[model samples]
Target: MTGCQGELVGQEVSLYIEDNEGNVIKDEIVTTQDNGFIDLWLPRDHLYRVTIKQGDLSAESEISTFEGDNTCITDMQLL
Candidate 1:
């Protein structure tokens, strides 16, 4: 990890989709840009698991998608 103040820049984040039966339906890997943000387009109408790891610290969340679902911000902790 880049020691740029423990920022999550250029970090690989995984956005995954699993079926009700725990089968992976779709998976995506996104890297944060210089602005410490990832611009991605995810399919709507599905449930997803998003995960990101910076150094030994990590973050994960479960999200439910719907039509017109555009953006999601779970936490804000970066310079």
Candidate 2:
């Protein structure tokens, strides 16, 4: 959430998430918390593609909920 850390807190963004199998998990607007972060709870042991957009900026990344995957995702960036 690099480009989203400070003033972007409480901002609403479009969130789109889908599983590797092409199942849509989430497709809606979400607000960042006080910490300028959005938390998503998905099923475990699966791979997912996530996209977040705020106005003209957007970020997309692949994530996994496997056992050894890092819970804290900090790589997705809005540019």
Candidate 3:
């Protein structure tokens, strides 16, 4: 993911995967590197939401659903 050079440096981000019943299946926390980048691996046939928290700034991506048997990547920015 790419963002304004001054927007996402040294931030705390989190990824969460949940099922249709809203049960949390997986969760991960990551710190944005110098490039404000994060790499994620997700399981197939699951629904997920990614939340990014940077100090008092926070943002959450839309709930996404995965189809095929493959991994996916997502990028989020905290406003």
Best TM-score among the predictions, by candidate number:
2
Greater TM-score among 1 and 2 belongs to: 2
Q: Between the candidate structures 2 and 3, which one is better when assessed by lDDT?
A: 2
TM-score of each: 0.55, 0.89, 0.56
> Per-residue lDDT for 57 in model 1?
55
Report the lDDT tens digits of candidate 1 across residue range 1-79.
5423335666876655564458776576767878677654556777766555545655666666676664655363421
TM-score of candidate 3 to 2 decimals: 0.56
Runs of candidate 2 exceeding 4 Å displacement:
1-7
- Winner of 1 and 3 under lDDT: 1
* Superposition TM-score, candidate 1 onto the true structure: 0.55
RMSD, every candidate, angstroms: 6.6, 3.6, 4.5
Predicted candidate 3 versus true structure: per-residue lDDT over 1-79, tens digit per residue: 7454434566766655565667776676777768656656555566665565655777776454456533433344567
Worst lDDT run of 10 residues, candidate 3, spans 68-77
